[model samples]
Target: MSRTDEHRRLAVLAGIDIDNPELRAKLDEVSARTAARLGQPVSLVSMVLDGAQFFAGSFGLQGWLAELNGTPIEWSFCVNAVQSRTPYVVTDARIDALYAANPLVHVDGLHRYAGVPIVVDGEVLGAHCVLGYEPGEFSRSDLEELRRGADEIVALLASHRLPRAAPLPP
Candidate 1:
């Protein structure tokens, strides 16, 4: 099987439903703490699946999309962090050519984004990330902490063995 196929399959085997309301209270604490630690208003713990990204936990996301479950990866900057297996950041999507045209920037008007991969046994599952509407620089130490937070998220996922979550709504 292809690595992509295996990655998707293992994601299923891990059995994390970050969006499950029953699981949110605990995950929400982690997310809220992550946001406080990173000093960002927007933070998310997400899992990448076949074509979309699921936010199992988050903070500072208000409005209609706040209740929405997932979004296509094409609309997610976390894709960069997951693919690289490292922290990815766009300090200013408005000024960065790489993200200048991204739908999250142009459509959602998000200006800053940063994330670290959620790696399990050498495979990237998805990302733990932060976002903001204002541009800001992240120090090397900040990136390191985000990476550590991603590791903590992995630990949390490993400690639980719940049933698989339903796929994102079509």
Candidate 2:
């Protein structure tokens, strides 16, 4: 599909408003499990939108970011995972040219990241990710854990999604 078509589809899916207590609870559980499994400081179920990336589920966040539950897309590594349609890993964003200047590296002191795309029905919607304050390698096993967490997140979203209406007869 074209980029425009993809964006439209994303808008429609996101417009259903996946924000709810039950979904959040389940997502938080997934995030916690991912963080523990990977030994990371934080985990997030991050959905990339047109303007911002919303944290559908998260753990180990503090301060204003935790309260806000999201940030502008410019600050998101999860966007890369969605765009690549595969796992995206950064050993150290502070040293990587592509991410060296990103505010999250400088301001938040977040260096390491591993993300797996959350895909459903052939469309990549977002990413499930783990973050760290220090630079380090993420093993293949780490990525695999993230993939499992991503799958769980997708299942939770599918269950909570609003059913689409059928098309009219021609």
Candidate 3:
């Protein structure tokens, strides 16, 4: 697909609202469906802000998720998505000069990655990404779907007004 088409698709997908209760449920449902439909190993809703990564929801694969919560920016693809403010799709991390040496790509053997940036009101918040153990490529439709999913996640966060949890008095 053309670059413009990709960006436009991302924008359209990012416009979905995930804050509403029904919408949030739908987002989760769709995420699960997408994972199955795409035959991917893992699908996740990730939010990046400042230096932390939050897992709003996930489907497929387990373990290390809790540890990943509130993780630093350096170890995350979501962070890279936000910093670059674009969708990153790596068909083969092992062949990519930039990511080949990255621990997540090398040691973890996460060879394939597809991530779309989540932006709200002109500010990049995080990303929603899908990963696989083997190298793979995503079609335009796949990228658009991922972008929409990410947008829904952003909307969910935006709808909530709860204050950030404060630590108890020590």
Give the winner by TM-score. Answer: 2
TM-score of each: 0.82, 0.91, 0.70
Which runs of model 2 end up more than 4 angstroms from their true locations? 15-17, 166-170
TM-score of 1: 0.82
Q: Give the per-residue lDDT digits (tens) of candidate 3, residues 1-170.
A: 35564465445434444344665565456568667767887777776644566655566645565455434556577777876889988899899877777777777678888889877666665677888999989998888889777767666656653444577899
How many steric overlaps are in each model, in order?
Answer: 1, 0, 1
Q: What C-alpha lDDT, on a 0 to 100 scale, does residue 51 get in candidate 1?
A: 77
Best candidate (score: lDDT): 2
lDDT of 2 by residue, 17-40 (tens): 487888999999999999998899
Better of 2 and 3 by lDDT: 2
- lDDT of each structure? 0.77, 0.87, 0.69
Tens-place lDDT digits, model 1, residues 87-153? 8989999989878887767877789988888886667887888888889888887777778888787
